[model samples]
Target: MGELRLMKGNEALAEAAIRAGVDGYFGYPITPQSEVIEYLMSEKPHERTGMVVLQAESEVASINMLYGGGGTGKKVMTSSSSPGISLMQEGLSYLAGAEIPCVVANVVRGGPGLGDIQPAQSDYFQSVKGGGHGDYRLFVIAPASVQEMSDFVPLAFDVAFKYRIPSLIVSDGLIGQMMEKVELFDPIPRLTDEEVIARYPWATNGKPKGKERRILTSLDLDPHKMERHNWALQEKYKLIEENETRFELIGCDDAEYIIVAYGSSSRIAQKSIQLARKKGIKVGLLRLITLWPFPKKPIEEFVKNGIKGFLTVEMSAGQMIEDVKLVVEGRAKVEHFGRYGGVIHSPEEVLEALEQKLIGG
Candidate 1:
C-alpha cells in the first residue's frame, strides 16, 4: 500500500497496467488515450520489468497483436478512443469468439466521424452492448474518476483471466485527462512463460509436452456445435451477470427518486445529489462501475425500496437510459438527460434536469 499522488487518468491507467504486471501492450495512439501509450513508452516497463510494449501501425494491427499476445495466455492489453476502437472491432469480435482473455481501455471521445478530442460517452453502446458483431459480451467497466481508472485496470485483468474472456475499461476524456491523487501499488506478479504455457496448452504455439496441437477458434461450421458454443457463451454471460454486477450507492436506500449515471456523467450526478440534498429533495444516486453487467440488482433494489423515478444521465444520445428502463421494469419511471458529440453535462445542468424531471413540477 502507498499514498495517493496527483496524476492524470491516462498516466494512472498506464501505471496501473504496469503495476498489474501486464506482459505485453499493443496499441495505436489516439487522443485522449495517447498518454497511456506515452507513459508506457517513457516508463519503458520492458527494460524495467521485462514487459513488452509496442506501438503498432494501426488500431487494426494493434488489436490483432493483442489477439496474438492474449492467445498465448499472457496478460496483455491495449487502449484507444472511439474511432480507433471502431477499427479494432473486427479483432475484438475475433477475440471474443475465441474467448481470449485480455484487457482493453477506451478513453472515449466524441464519435460517429472524427467526432472530437473532447470527452464523450458516445461509446456506451459500443462498449456495453458489444461494439463488434457477435452474440458475445465484453466485461465493460466504466470509471468516473482517475481513481477508478487506476483501480479498475488491475480488476479488469483479474476478471479477464478468471473467465478467459475479454474485459474492457470504458473511460472518457474527462477522467483520462484530469489529474487526481492516486494511491499506487506494487506490481503484481507477472505470469512466467512456462506458467502461461502450462495454463494454455491450447494456445497457438508448438505442441505442449505430451499433448497434440491445440487450435483456438470461435468458428464452428456444424450447426450443432455452433448452437452448443452459443449456449455455452450464454451460460458464461449469466455467470458474469450474477457475480460481476458492480455499482456505488449514495442515498437510494431511503429516497423517492434515484439518479442513475456512470462514467464522467456520474461525477456530475454526484455533485447534483449533494445540491439536491441541501434543498431537501431526497435524491440518491447509483453510479455504475461495471456498465456491461449493468448493475441491475441495485436498480431493482431501489425499485423495491419504493423509488418512483430515475434520471439517467450520460454524454450520449440516451443510450444507457434504455438499459435502465429495461431494468426498472415499469416499477419506476426512467427519463434520460444527455449531451452528445463532445459536450459534457455539467453539475448545474444535471441539477436543472433533476428539478424539471424528478425533483420539481
Candidate 2:
C-alpha cells in the first residue's frame, strides 16, 4: 500500500531503478527494451536524484562501462534484448572474473541469430548456463508480472552487491511491454561516496590516500593462482545455490501432476492450472523464480510425494527441459512443450500439452 499506480513493465523497472538508489545506468537501445532507456531519459534522473543515465555507443561499450563503474563500488546496471545481450558476453565474463557486482536485465526476444523482436524465452541457456568463456554463473531471477518487474530491480541489485557477482533479471518481452496496476516501493537514499568506499573495502575507490593500493583485474599469469581463483568462484556459486534460490508452489499439496515453468510462461501456466483443475486433473504449478539454481530441491521433493509427471512449458526449443529431466532422473515422466521463434501458447494449448505430455494422453 505504499503508492498505487498503473505502469508498463519497462517504465516501472526504470522508476524502480531510480528509487533503488542506482548510481548509474549504461545501455544502448534495442526493440522490446528500448522503453527502459526512453523512460530513464524522459525522467532525467541526473537532475532528480543525481543518478547518471547514459546511452552508450553500443552494447559492448555499455557492458564495459558497467565493469568500470561497478569496480569502483557503484551500483551500476544495464538493460538489453537478445542480440544486444549477446554482444555483452565477453564483458560479462570480465566482470565475473573481477568479482564486480552489477545488475543486467534482458527483456528477451526470439533469437538464435537475430530471430525476431517478439517476446520469447529462447535465452534460457544463455542466462542460466555459462554464456561466456570460463567457469562462472549469473544469479538469474525471473519476474513473472509487471509487479515483479518493479519489485525485482532492487532485489537484483541487493543480491548482486551482496554476493559481489553479476545478477540478471531475465524477463521476457511480454513482461517488458505489458501494463498492470502496481504498488511502488518507498525510495531508498543513494549511498554516499564515502559510504561506498567504506562498505566495499575491495573497491578501487581512489585507494584512499594512505591505504594499500587495490587493483581490480581478471588477469592472472600464474596457472596455480588462476586455478585457485576458479575454485573460489565455484564455491561462491554453491553458496548462492544454498542461500539465494527462490520459487513458488501453488495448489501442489494435492496435485497429481505439476507444470514447471518460469517468467511469462509461469503466468500462463497458472491459468492453465485452473483449467486443468476444472477438468478434475488435480494438477499444480511450480513457478521458478530463480533460474540458475534450478530449484532442484522442490522438484525432488515433489517426486518423493509420488507425483505422476512434470510438464515443462517454455517459449523455447526444449532448453530448460534438459535441467528438469536431469533433476527428475527418470523417477517420473518429464516432458516439454513449447512454441518458439515468437509464438505464445494459449492456456488451452498449455493444458492440452499437459494432458498429452504428462497425463499420459
Candidate 3:
C-alpha cells in the first residue's frame, strides 16, 4: 500500500495501470478520458517499467494495436469516449472472435452521433449488449466512484486474461473528471517472456522448442469450424455468468421498492435512497458492478422475496430497464427514469420519479 492521494479518476486509472504492470497502452485523444493517456505519457511508464504507450492515428488503429499486443499475451488496454469507442467496435468484434484478452475503458458521454462531452450512461446498450457484429459479449464493469475507477483497471485485465475474453470498464464523464481520495498500490512487476509463455501457451509470441506456431485470427472459412468456435464462446459466457455476476445490495433486506442503477446513476440513486429512507419510504438500491454477467439471479430473488416494484435510473432512455424487466417478468412492476443528451438527474428528481412511478402508481 502507498500513501492516499486525491486524484482525478482518469489519472487514477492511468497510475493504476502502471502499478498493475500493463505491458502496453494504445489510444487516441478523447474528451473526458484524455487524462488517462496524458498521465501515462507524463509519467513515462516505459522508463519506469518497460511499458509501451503510443498515441494512435485513430481509434481504429488503437484497437488494432491492442489486438496485436493482446494476441502476443501482453497486458494491454485503451480508453476512449462514446464516439471514439464506437470507432473501435469492429476491432472489438474481431478481438472477441479471436479470443484476445485486453481491457477497454469507456468514459461515457452523451451520444447518438458525436454527442456532447458531458456525463451520460447512453452507451449502456452498446457497452453491454455487444456494440460490434457477431454474437459476442464484453465483460462489462461499471465503476461508480473514482476509487472504483482506479481499482477496476487491474481487475478487468485479470479477469480478461483469466477467461481469454475482452473486458470493458464502463464509466461516465462524471467519474472520469471527478477527483477523490484514493489509496494507491505498489507497482507489480511485469511478466517475463518465459512467464508469459508459461501462462499463455497459446499466445503467438514465438514457436518455442517442439511447440507448434499459434495462429491468432477470427476468420474461419469453414462454417462448421466457426460454429464450433461460437459454441466454445457460449460455454465460456455461461461459466462467467455463473461465477462472475457481481453487485452491491443496499437496504434491500427490508424494502418495498428497489432502484436499479449502475455507474454514475448508481451514485445518484444512492442519494435518492437516503432521501426516500428519511421520508419513511422503504426504498433500497441494487447497484450493478458487472453489467454483462448481469446480477439477474439476485434481481429475481428480490422479486421472489416479495419486493413491490423496481425503478431503473439511467442517463439513457431506459436501456438497462430491459434487463430488469426480463428478470422481473410480470411478477412486479418495473418503470424507467432517465436524463439523456448530456443531462443528469438530481437525487431529488430521482426520488420524485421513484415515488410517482413505483410508489404512487
Query: Which ten residues in a row are the worst by lDDT in model 3?
Result: 205-214
TM-score of each: 0.97, 0.99, 0.99
Estimate the overall C-alpha local distance difference test score of candidate 3. 0.93
The residue-by-residue lDDT of candidate 2 on 1-361, one tens digit each, is 6899888899999999999999999999998999999999999998888999999999999999999999999999999999999999999999999999999999999988988988999999999887899888999999999999999999999888888999999998999999998899999888999999889999987966677999888899999999999999999999999999899999999999989999999999999999888899999899999998789999999998888999999999888989988988999999888898988888999999988777765
Model 1 per-residue lDDT tens digits across residues 1-361: 6867999999999999988999999988888889999999999998877888999999999899989889888889999999999998888889998989999999999987899999999888888788789898999999888888999998998889877789999999999999988988777878887777777665775675787777789888998998898899899989998999899887776678888898889889989888988988888888988998888888888888778789999999889998989988887788888888998887888888988977564
Q: What would the TM-score be for candidate 3 when compared with the true structure?
A: 0.99
Clashes per model (N, Cα, C within 3 A): 0, 0, 0
Per-residue CA lDDT of candidate 3, range 72-124, in tens?
99999999999999999999999999999999999999989999999999998
In model 3, which runs have C-alpha deviations exceeding 4 angstroms? Answer: none
